[model samples]
Target: MSVDKTFYVTTPIYYVNDKPHIGHAYTTLACDVLARFKRLDGYDVKFLTGTDEHGQKVEKSAEGFGTSPQELADRNSANFRELAARLDCSNDDFIRTTEPRHIRSVQALWARLVAAGDIYVGHYEGWYSVRDEAFYGEDELVPGPNGTKHAPSGAPVEWVKEPSYFFRLSAWQDRLLAWYEANPDCIGPQSRRNEVISFVKGGLQDLSVSRTSFKWGIPVPGDDAHVMYVWLDALTNYITAIGYPDITGEFARYWPADLHMVGKDIVRFHAVYWPAFLMAAGLEPPRRVFAHGWWTNEGQKISKSVGNVIDPVALIERYGLDQVRYFLLREVPFGNDGDFSHRAMVQRMNSELANDYGNLAQRVLSMIGKNCAGQVPQHGEPGADDREMLDAAHGLLPKVRDAIDRQLFHEALEAMWGVIRAANGYVDRQAPWALKKTDPARMGTVLWVLAETVRNLALLTQAFMPAASGRLLDQLGIGPDARTLHHCGSHHALKPGTPLPAPAGVFPRFVEEEGAA
Candidate 1:
């Protein structure tokens, strides 16, 4: 990919009905890593994440807590903001559905679709799920183990008949299938794409875009009897954050997002409904929708009733911020479900961060400070071992880049760590401390190789662990700007004779104690 490409990525604006959880953090962290990577690679990147403030869930949750919807939104949205900060997320915009800009954009979209004769007033009679805020067709219903039928998507359903406005989604089925066929990468993860294609092929139903029973959402334009469906109100957040409608110039530049990172359960709305709405309004669909998997707590599904919903703030407080971020991205593949456990988090921190990356940095900086008069040594000539290590570091750049581009975050981190491991092994084999007396020139070459390897590792790890990598770069006397992903393959990031700073522990190990209490 071109380094100058513009990349627009979004995490689904989380609903504000509840406090932020591990699942929400996982999606945002994935987006953050991708955004940070793109920016480092010289892409003009826009990363959007925020809370969805208008929905029945939010209104009811507020009433249950004896607060107004706005107050509830403010509280939960603030919670999400704090959680994002704790995770070191670099989001460019935080959109709220209640913002005037969002209301205007959603209304404008509604008018455009109405003008195209794709929207009309009608009565919607179906099973509506208050928990999910979605209407389910009968075919999607399954008998639960509780002897009650529920939506297969894990939401309860209630039969409702009400006057509402509907979008002519059935009319776009053939067109959507053709678009999917033409653009195989539009929906992401071959399985998700196939599921969407099959659903479209089976047939499409007209989607109810307005709910008459809800008054807390955005009002339907010129229609007092109904409010916009939560999904319609929610998905418009993408354009609203970019100054849509009134600021056509700005909106036109980034209106069609490069990627929408969403949960797998809602992939239908993003890949199917959102695209159909865009096509009806004579706008292009988003470039891609990547649906990631969910996280269960300790191998069991998280449930509030069971008292096991993982609070994000609590996790960040227990584990350090970036430690939590690294664990989530590194623990599971982006598209597969993962089980979160305290034990697993402790293991990753001690084994990977502390033992692997942090220890290597401490060892190299200590050697340079002690042997080379606290100055970076020049890479004079490489023997067989030095050449092999250099070759290994050089080989990792492409693999890491490819993994990031493909959205395999864990794999990308793994590929980078492979170099860290190899470089550490090279140091052990060369025994630079012993060579200092017997072979000074050979020792210089080995230390040079070690310093160069550390420099490259710092560059690669910066995306995943920015704070720790920044410390690593500072110790090597390399400026922040020189640590960009583009500089990964450069042979000499640290100039000879550059004064080095004393290194500190980046990732201190977490130890579990015996029964002391």
Candidate 2:
């Protein structure tokens, strides 16, 4: 693919102070789905994810663990990297903020901002949340117990006063609002965009860009005592991963990333500060920043103290991998809060996957195996029902493409399942088994039509459930080269008389043990 066909997407580099959780998996899975969809559509896609290692949180956590910060970062970063593989995320690059290349890239960005007169030495006094690595103004804090104050996120704050470098965020207020107005789609979900606009319009302040009290972050260029603030250093990872400061290689090809997928809590950093930082440095901001909502487990907010943080690995171990992936993206609308329950997961698994889609593939293939001599049944055409079903299956590409472009994963899956439900009804209405006796040739055409529909369904579904879709396509005798989005219409229908593999269930029904929770 050429540069014009490139699509770059990213997940926030996760913090190393916390273990991998469902939130991390959720954000990355959404990006993976988008990247996969773009690739199938013939775009040269770059999917980037990694760990954010520099921050006072990680430094303090390192002290508590009785290890050096680097050692702590190393061990925890490896766990996150392993999680990506376990979740089957198809990321193109895994970057660590601690890498030497990143350090150089960050320093170069600092130089650019300094040359632009955006950074200057100043005294900073404010409430800082080490946990969130953010500065909170007086109005944003909530009253806590014992006359203390806490950040809106509920993380405790501490008063800090020191000499630091400041970014002229206040100076960019009008420009930022103008950019938001000019490029309305730059920030996603409409709700998030409104929140960011309100925050900026209320007032912008010169943001502190360096910390003198903590030595765990990237040091400001030419200043040894002060280190760059965590958000400044962390947000640069997006550009650094693609070789920033050179803008001649991958950076030139994929800069101005197509999308940056993040959780809702950090919208201020991506939508506000990160873009300002880039524009100051003579670089283009990413095309879009999508902030998805949080997930609660069984009605309670997921917290370590609650002892209910959903581990992605454990979820996959209990239910199948694709089962977990499908339920996550299918269970709730993107950009909205969702609850995770065992009941809901199992229901989707059994009814949607097993009964609706899985059973459709099984019955049709089983008939071919037994009645059609175990090969793709030859079809004699011109039936209205067949045309309607085929057209629906073939038409799914555009509907899904539109939904996914807007980051509507659940809607895309629902559109695909709509056809699945119709295919099930088609089978019932056609009654291929009844035709087996009266008109054997008519039964063959119905079965062939169903098979062609399944082939298209599998092709479109490969983005959401890669492993399961690949297995389904394999059962249909689809070659690896013939599985892209272009291969989904009638032009690429399954060939007659091609030998299919023995039929087996792709999505198994989830059964709960009697004594389990």
Candidate 3:
């Protein structure tokens, strides 16, 4: 696709019941990388990420903290903003459910669905989970180790009976299945798609769209007794962000989102409920929904009670922000659960970033400083090795692009690094230092190949490791405009004889323990 095409993507708005953790950072970083990549490829991209402020959990947590819900939302929402900034997330908009725009949009959506007769006043008697802000059926309940039963949906269950509002979700099963069949890619990561499909196939009961007990959520239109269901309220943030009620010219431009990147736990909401809501409102579903996996602490599930959750800020401070981003995307396949260990993270930094990309950049820049008088070398002529290495680097652009488009982040990074590895091996075997003493022209050719490879590497890495890649490009004397994905395969990126800057270590080797290598 052309870079000029519009690509609207989002990370699920996170709940502010707790502070940001590594899992939240992982999803945001993934979206940021994709956003940066699309932008570098020259696309008009809208990347949305934000905090979901109104929910029962947030209310209870705020009460426990001895603060009002709004106060807690303000404090914790700032923490999320700081976390995003610390990780260099490039989200264009941050919507809060408490915002007026969102309130208006949710009301607008509710009115539309009600007008369409998809919503009805009803009595709800079910197992409600205040922790999850969801209601579960008997089949979805699991016996807890304790006396209390838990919702298999990852929420604590409570028996409740109240007069509330419900959406006719059960009536749309056939319609949802037809939509899925027509738009096969609507739900992503084939496994997640199959899971959602099976869940809907087994059956979808009517969804309770209001809670009488929670006052921290959006109030239902013309009904003071109930608040909008948290998911319904939360999902409206997407359209709310684009001026849903107003539908101004700018809002209409990006109405149907190109992609919604969410955690696996919320797949049903984004894929099932959100689409059903949109269909009822006479709007198109989001183009795609990608449900990625969770991150555990060294193979143990992360839990607040366990007190082992990885903090993104601490990780960024201990390592660097780019290091954190690289580790999250590179260490785990995007859609599969992976263990987070300090040892594994350090190893990846030392081996991949420090040893491979960092070493290659340091060597090439140092060689240019010493042999070529701190200037990019003039290419005398292309040899077999040079041609072969250039071809390899060129071949990677398409593969990496395709992988990224498929949302295979790890595969994309690996494909890009293959060229980095090849170029490093070529440098080691060619030994530009020795060639400089024996044959100056051959040395220039070898240095040219290495510099060219570095140029391409800088472009490819810019999306994932912007800070480090910017440093590498600065040392190579490549301009900001030259550091784009489109310029990766081209050999004319570096101007011959451009005065290169001094070499500095971009990624220092990560050391662990007292004396271990």
- Top candidate by lDDT: 2
| Per-residue lDDT of 344 in model 2 | 95
* Candidate order by decreasing lDDT: 2, 3, 1
Candidates in order, TM-scores: namely 0.96, 0.99, 0.97
Model 3, TM vs. native: 0.97
* Model 2 per-residue lDDT tens digits across residues 40-140: 99999999999999989998999999999999999999999999999899999999999999999999999999999999998999999999999999999
For candidate 3, write residues 306-370 as lDDT tens digits.
99988889888888888989999999888999999989989999999999989988988898899
Best by TM-score: 2
Give the lDDT of residue 409 in candidate 3. Answer: 95
Supply the global lDDT for candidate 1: 0.86
Q: For model 2, which pairs clash?
A: none
lDDT by residue for model 1 (1-517), tens: 4634888999999988867888898889889999998888888889999989987888888889999999999988998888788888999988888888899999999999999999999899998888888888899898876787799877777898999899999999999998998888898777898889998999899999998776899999999779999999899888888887764755676768999999999999999999999889888899899988889999898998888999888877777887888899999988888999999999999988899888888888888888888899766768788888888886777888898877889899888788889887988898989999998777878887888888888888877888888888888898866777778764545678888877677889986657621
Indicate the worst ten consecutive residues by lDDT in candidate 3. 508-517
